[model samples]
Target: MLENLLPPLNDHNLPYPDTIHPIVVHFVIAMVLFAVFCDGVGYFSRNSKLYEVSWWNLFFATISIFVAVMFGQIEAGLALAYPASESTLNLHTILGWSLSGIIAAITAWRYVLRLRDPKTLPIGFIVVGVVLTVLVCFQVYLGDELVWVYGLHTVPVVEALKEGVL
Candidate 1:
Protein backbone atom coordinates (compact mmCIF):
# COMPACT_ATOMS: atom_id res chain seq x y z
CA MET A 1 0.00 0.00 0.00
CA LEU A 2 1.10 3.60 -0.61
CA GLU A 3 0.68 4.21 3.09
CA ASN A 4 3.72 2.05 3.79
CA LEU A 5 5.91 4.46 1.81
CA LEU A 6 4.81 7.49 3.76
CA PRO A 7 7.32 9.25 5.98
CA PRO A 8 7.32 8.72 9.71
CA LEU A 9 6.17 11.50 12.04
CA ASN A 10 8.99 13.75 13.13
CA ASP A 11 10.15 14.49 16.66
CA HIS A 12 7.72 17.37 16.59
CA ASN A 13 5.00 14.79 16.04
CA LEU A 14 4.20 16.11 12.59
CA PRO A 15 4.42 14.52 9.17
CA TYR A 16 5.97 17.71 7.87
CA PRO A 17 8.63 20.02 9.29
CA ASP A 18 7.41 21.79 12.43
CA THR A 19 4.33 22.90 14.30
CA ILE A 20 1.85 25.05 12.37
CA HIS A 21 -0.21 26.07 15.35
CA PRO A 22 2.31 28.53 16.82
CA ILE A 23 2.87 30.18 13.46
CA VAL A 24 -0.84 30.69 12.86
CA VAL A 25 -1.58 31.60 16.44
CA HIS A 26 1.07 34.33 16.45
CA PHE A 27 -0.58 36.00 13.50
CA VAL A 28 -3.97 35.85 15.19
CA ILE A 29 -2.48 37.31 18.33
CA ALA A 30 -0.91 40.19 16.47
CA MET A 31 -4.11 40.98 14.66
CA VAL A 32 -6.18 40.90 17.85
CA LEU A 33 -3.78 43.02 19.89
CA PHE A 34 -3.28 45.45 17.04
CA ALA A 35 -7.01 45.71 16.52
CA VAL A 36 -7.51 46.51 20.17
CA PHE A 37 -4.83 49.19 20.04
CA CYS A 38 -6.40 50.70 16.93
CA ASP A 39 -9.80 50.69 18.59
CA GLY A 40 -8.47 52.43 21.69
CA VAL A 41 -6.60 55.09 19.75
CA GLY A 42 -9.43 55.59 17.30
CA TYR A 43 -11.95 55.97 20.07
CA PHE A 44 -9.81 58.46 21.96
CA SER A 45 -8.61 60.49 19.00
CA ARG A 46 -11.92 60.42 17.13
CA ASN A 47 -10.06 59.14 14.12
CA SER A 48 -12.39 57.52 11.61
CA LYS A 49 -9.57 55.98 9.64
CA LEU A 50 -8.27 54.10 12.63
CA TYR A 51 -11.78 52.85 13.34
CA GLU A 52 -11.93 51.49 9.80
CA VAL A 53 -8.54 49.92 10.31
CA SER A 54 -9.63 48.42 13.60
CA TRP A 55 -12.76 46.94 12.03
CA TRP A 56 -10.85 45.30 9.21
CA ASN A 57 -8.29 43.95 11.67
CA LEU A 58 -11.02 42.47 13.84
CA PHE A 59 -12.74 40.94 10.81
CA PHE A 60 -9.54 39.33 9.62
CA ALA A 61 -8.68 38.20 13.12
CA THR A 62 -12.06 36.52 13.41
CA ILE A 63 -11.40 34.58 10.23
CA SER A 64 -7.81 33.77 11.18
CA ILE A 65 -8.73 32.54 14.65
CA PHE A 66 -10.50 29.56 13.15
CA VAL A 67 -7.45 28.60 11.15
CA ALA A 68 -5.26 28.96 14.22
CA VAL A 69 -7.62 26.89 16.33
CA MET A 70 -7.80 24.13 13.73
CA PHE A 71 -4.04 23.83 13.56
CA GLY A 72 -3.74 24.03 17.34
CA GLN A 73 -6.18 21.15 17.71
CA ILE A 74 -4.31 19.02 15.21
CA GLU A 75 -0.91 19.74 16.77
CA ALA A 76 -2.16 19.25 20.29
CA GLY A 77 -3.50 15.84 19.39
CA LEU A 78 -0.16 14.92 17.88
CA ALA A 79 1.86 16.36 20.79
CA LEU A 80 1.55 13.18 22.91
CA ALA A 81 1.77 15.40 25.97
CA TYR A 82 3.09 13.98 29.23
CA PRO A 83 1.58 14.34 32.70
CA ALA A 84 3.52 17.49 33.57
CA SER A 85 2.20 19.27 30.49
CA GLU A 86 -1.27 17.76 30.44
CA SER A 87 -3.10 20.28 32.58
CA THR A 88 -1.68 23.29 30.77
CA LEU A 89 -2.37 21.66 27.42
CA ASN A 90 -5.95 20.94 28.37
CA LEU A 91 -6.52 24.54 29.49
CA HIS A 92 -4.90 25.87 26.35
CA THR A 93 -7.09 23.65 24.20
CA ILE A 94 -10.25 24.70 25.96
CA LEU A 95 -9.37 28.37 25.86
CA GLY A 96 -8.30 28.22 22.23
CA TRP A 97 -11.65 26.76 21.19
CA SER A 98 -13.50 29.25 23.33
CA LEU A 99 -11.51 32.13 21.81
CA SER A 100 -12.47 31.14 18.28
CA GLY A 101 -16.16 31.47 19.11
CA ILE A 102 -15.65 34.60 21.16
CA ILE A 103 -13.70 36.26 18.41
CA ALA A 104 -16.43 35.45 15.91
CA ALA A 105 -19.10 36.88 18.17
CA ILE A 106 -17.06 40.00 18.83
CA THR A 107 -16.51 40.46 15.11
CA ALA A 108 -20.25 40.22 14.54
CA TRP A 109 -20.90 42.78 17.23
CA ARG A 110 -18.24 45.03 15.70
CA TYR A 111 -19.98 44.69 12.34
CA VAL A 112 -23.16 46.01 13.85
CA LEU A 113 -21.33 48.90 15.45
CA ARG A 114 -19.56 49.74 12.23
CA LEU A 115 -22.80 49.75 10.31
CA ARG A 116 -24.44 52.03 12.84
CA ASP A 117 -21.59 54.55 12.85
CA PRO A 118 -18.62 54.52 10.58
CA LYS A 119 -16.72 57.44 12.11
CA THR A 120 -17.06 56.65 15.79
CA LEU A 121 -16.61 53.74 18.19
CA PRO A 122 -18.07 53.15 21.62
CA ILE A 123 -15.80 53.23 24.64
CA GLY A 124 -17.50 50.07 25.81
CA PHE A 125 -16.25 48.30 22.73
CA ILE A 126 -12.73 49.44 23.50
CA VAL A 127 -13.11 48.21 27.07
CA VAL A 128 -14.21 44.83 25.83
CA GLY A 129 -11.27 44.80 23.46
CA VAL A 130 -8.88 45.38 26.34
CA VAL A 131 -10.44 42.52 28.27
CA LEU A 132 -10.13 40.27 25.23
CA THR A 133 -6.49 41.28 24.98
CA VAL A 134 -5.96 40.19 28.56
CA LEU A 135 -7.46 36.82 27.86
CA VAL A 136 -5.27 36.46 24.79
CA CYS A 137 -2.19 37.29 26.83
CA PHE A 138 -3.11 34.57 29.29
CA GLN A 139 -3.51 32.10 26.46
CA VAL A 140 -0.12 33.10 25.18
CA TYR A 141 1.41 32.47 28.58
CA LEU A 142 -0.10 28.99 28.69
CA GLY A 143 1.21 28.23 25.23
CA ASP A 144 4.64 29.53 26.17
CA GLU A 145 4.69 27.34 29.23
CA LEU A 146 3.78 24.34 27.15
CA VAL A 147 6.66 24.91 24.79
CA TRP A 148 9.34 26.34 27.06
CA VAL A 149 8.57 24.93 30.48
CA TYR A 150 6.91 21.63 29.61
CA GLY A 151 8.74 21.05 26.30
CA LEU A 152 5.82 19.18 24.86
CA HIS A 153 6.91 18.57 21.26
CA THR A 154 10.49 19.71 21.16
CA VAL A 155 13.14 17.34 19.83
CA PRO A 156 14.67 16.56 23.22
CA VAL A 157 11.29 16.09 24.81
CA VAL A 158 10.11 13.71 22.12
CA GLU A 159 13.32 11.72 22.30
CA ALA A 160 13.07 11.53 26.04
CA LEU A 161 9.53 10.28 25.81
CA LYS A 162 10.54 7.58 23.34
CA GLU A 163 13.50 6.50 25.47
CA GLY A 164 11.33 6.45 28.58
CA VAL A 165 13.42 9.19 30.16
CA LEU A 166 10.52 11.56 30.74
Candidate 2:
Protein backbone atom coordinates (compact mmCIF):
# COMPACT_ATOMS: atom_id res chain seq x y z
CA MET A 1 0.00 0.00 0.00
CA LEU A 2 2.78 2.41 0.86
CA GLU A 3 4.49 1.37 -2.35
CA ASN A 4 1.51 2.75 -4.26
CA LEU A 5 2.18 6.22 -2.90
CA LEU A 6 5.93 6.14 -3.40
CA PRO A 7 7.69 6.45 -6.71
CA PRO A 8 9.37 3.38 -8.16
CA LEU A 9 12.99 2.87 -7.31
CA ASN A 10 15.24 3.84 -10.21
CA ASP A 11 18.38 2.30 -11.71
CA HIS A 12 20.35 2.92 -8.55
CA ASN A 13 17.55 1.23 -6.54
CA LEU A 14 16.84 4.55 -4.85
CA PRO A 15 13.56 6.43 -5.16
CA TYR A 16 15.70 8.90 -7.11
CA PRO A 17 18.40 7.18 -9.12
CA ASP A 18 20.87 10.04 -8.76
CA THR A 19 22.67 10.11 -5.43
CA ILE A 20 22.06 13.22 -3.33
CA HIS A 21 24.99 12.45 -1.01
CA PRO A 22 27.69 13.28 -3.56
CA ILE A 23 25.99 16.45 -4.63
CA VAL A 24 25.68 17.74 -1.09
CA VAL A 25 29.00 16.35 0.13
CA HIS A 26 30.93 18.11 -2.62
CA PHE A 27 29.61 21.41 -1.31
CA VAL A 28 30.72 20.52 2.20
CA ILE A 29 34.15 19.55 0.93
CA ALA A 30 34.54 22.73 -1.07
CA MET A 31 33.41 24.93 1.80
CA VAL A 32 35.77 23.23 4.21
CA LEU A 33 38.78 23.50 1.94
CA PHE A 34 37.97 27.08 1.06
CA ALA A 35 37.57 27.99 4.71
CA VAL A 36 40.96 26.54 5.49
CA PHE A 37 42.48 28.35 2.53
CA CYS A 38 40.98 31.63 3.62
CA ASP A 39 42.28 31.16 7.12
CA GLY A 40 45.75 30.31 5.87
CA VAL A 41 45.83 33.36 3.63
CA GLY A 42 44.51 35.53 6.40
CA TYR A 43 47.24 34.26 8.67
CA PHE A 44 50.10 34.66 6.23
CA SER A 45 48.98 37.96 4.72
CA ARG A 46 47.79 39.38 8.04
CA ASN A 47 44.56 40.26 6.34
CA SER A 48 41.74 40.58 8.89
CA LYS A 49 39.15 40.69 6.12
CA LEU A 50 39.92 37.10 5.10
CA TYR A 51 39.23 36.03 8.67
CA GLU A 52 35.66 37.23 8.31
CA VAL A 53 35.36 35.24 5.09
CA SER A 54 36.85 32.21 6.78
CA TRP A 55 34.46 32.51 9.71
CA TRP A 56 31.43 32.70 7.45
CA ASN A 57 32.62 29.73 5.41
CA LEU A 58 33.18 27.68 8.55
CA PHE A 59 29.75 28.71 9.86
CA PHE A 60 28.03 27.58 6.68
CA ALA A 61 30.13 24.38 6.55
CA THR A 62 29.05 23.40 10.07
CA ILE A 63 25.44 23.51 8.95
CA SER A 64 26.05 21.86 5.56
CA ILE A 65 28.14 18.99 6.88
CA PHE A 66 25.17 17.72 8.86
CA VAL A 67 23.06 17.71 5.72
CA ALA A 68 25.83 15.93 3.83
CA VAL A 69 26.15 13.34 6.58
CA MET A 70 22.42 12.70 6.62
CA PHE A 71 22.35 12.05 2.88
CA GLY A 72 25.55 10.00 3.12
CA GLN A 73 24.10 7.74 5.81
CA ILE A 74 20.96 7.14 3.78
CA GLU A 75 22.80 6.50 0.51
CA ALA A 76 25.46 4.35 2.13
CA GLY A 77 22.81 2.20 3.74
CA LEU A 78 21.06 1.81 0.41
CA ALA A 79 24.29 1.03 -1.48
CA LEU A 80 24.82 -2.53 -2.63
CA ALA A 81 28.18 -3.70 -1.41
CA TYR A 82 30.25 -6.59 -2.69
CA PRO A 83 33.03 -8.25 -0.69
CA ALA A 84 35.81 -6.10 -2.09
CA SER A 85 33.96 -2.87 -1.46
CA GLU A 86 32.47 -3.80 1.91
CA SER A 87 35.45 -2.93 4.10
CA THR A 88 36.10 0.29 2.21
CA LEU A 89 32.44 1.24 2.55
CA ASN A 90 32.59 0.62 6.30
CA LEU A 91 35.70 2.76 6.62
CA HIS A 92 34.14 5.50 4.53
CA THR A 93 31.03 5.49 6.69
CA ILE A 94 33.06 5.72 9.89
CA LEU A 95 35.27 8.52 8.55
CA GLY A 96 32.29 10.43 7.21
CA TRP A 97 30.74 10.52 10.66
CA SER A 98 34.07 11.41 12.21
CA LEU A 99 34.55 14.26 9.75
CA SER A 100 31.13 15.65 10.64
CA GLY A 101 32.00 15.68 14.33
CA ILE A 102 35.38 17.25 13.65
CA ILE A 103 33.85 19.96 11.48
CA ALA A 104 31.29 20.81 14.18
CA ALA A 105 33.93 20.91 16.89
CA ILE A 106 36.20 23.14 14.88
CA THR A 107 33.33 25.43 14.06
CA ALA A 108 32.49 25.72 17.74
CA TRP A 109 36.09 26.50 18.55
CA ARG A 110 36.23 29.14 15.86
CA TYR A 111 32.98 30.63 17.10
CA VAL A 112 34.43 30.98 20.58
CA LEU A 113 37.54 32.62 19.21
CA ARG A 114 35.43 34.98 17.11
CA LEU A 115 33.43 36.03 20.14
CA ARG A 116 36.60 36.50 22.20
CA ASP A 117 38.42 38.56 19.58
CA PRO A 118 37.16 39.23 16.10
CA LYS A 119 40.21 41.29 15.16
CA THR A 120 42.71 38.44 15.14
CA LEU A 121 42.74 34.69 14.51
CA PRO A 122 45.44 32.71 16.26
CA ILE A 123 48.11 30.75 14.38
CA GLY A 124 47.22 27.68 16.45
CA PHE A 125 43.69 27.75 15.06
CA ILE A 126 45.08 28.07 11.56
CA VAL A 127 47.18 24.96 12.17
CA VAL A 128 44.07 23.12 13.28
CA GLY A 129 42.40 24.19 10.07
CA VAL A 130 45.29 22.65 8.16
CA VAL A 131 44.71 19.38 9.98
CA LEU A 132 41.04 19.52 9.10
CA THR A 133 41.97 20.14 5.46
CA VAL A 134 44.13 17.00 5.46
CA LEU A 135 41.32 14.90 6.87
CA VAL A 136 38.93 16.26 4.27
CA CYS A 137 41.35 15.32 1.49
CA PHE A 138 41.56 11.77 2.82
CA GLN A 139 37.78 11.56 2.97
CA VAL A 140 37.56 12.75 -0.62
CA TYR A 141 39.93 9.93 -1.65
CA LEU A 142 37.75 7.33 0.06
CA GLY A 143 34.61 8.73 -1.57
CA ASP A 144 36.33 8.68 -4.95
CA GLU A 145 37.34 5.07 -4.42
CA LEU A 146 33.74 4.17 -3.74
CA VAL A 147 32.35 5.90 -6.81
CA TRP A 148 35.24 5.73 -9.29
CA VAL A 149 36.93 2.49 -8.28
CA TYR A 150 34.09 0.44 -6.83
CA GLY A 151 31.38 2.08 -8.93
CA LEU A 152 28.77 2.02 -6.22
CA HIS A 153 25.28 2.73 -7.62
CA THR A 154 26.73 3.20 -11.09
CA VAL A 155 24.95 1.81 -14.11
CA PRO A 156 26.94 -1.39 -14.45
CA VAL A 157 26.70 -2.21 -10.77
CA VAL A 158 22.96 -1.68 -10.81
CA GLU A 159 22.64 -3.97 -13.80
CA ALA A 160 24.71 -6.63 -12.08
CA LEU A 161 22.52 -6.34 -9.01
CA LYS A 162 19.43 -6.80 -11.14
CA GLU A 163 20.98 -9.97 -12.57
CA GLY A 164 21.92 -11.25 -9.10
CA VAL A 165 25.56 -11.37 -10.15
CA LEU A 166 26.83 -9.08 -7.38
RMSD of each: 1.5, 1.3
Top-scoring candidate (lDDT): 1
Best TM-score among the predictions, by candidate number: 1
Error at 106, model 2, angstroms: 0.4
Off by over 4 Å in 2: 1-6
Q: How far in Å is the alpha carbon of 30 misplaced in model 1?
A: 0.4
TM-score, one value per model: 0.95, 0.95
Superposition error at 26 for model 1 (Å)? 0.7
Q: Which stretch of 10 consecutive residues in model 2 shows the poorest summed lDDT? A: 8-17
Q: Superpose all Cα atoms of candidate 2 onto the true structure and report the RMSD in Å to 1 decimal.
A: 1.3
Candidate 1 yields a Cα-based lDDT of 0.90
lDDT (10s digit) by residue, model 2, range 30-118: 88999999888888888888889888988898889899989988888878888899998999989999988999999999989999988
Local accuracy of candidate 1 as per-residue lDDT tens digits, 68-137: 9998888898897999899999999999999999999989999998899888877788889999999999
Worst 10 residues of 1 by lDDT: 6-15
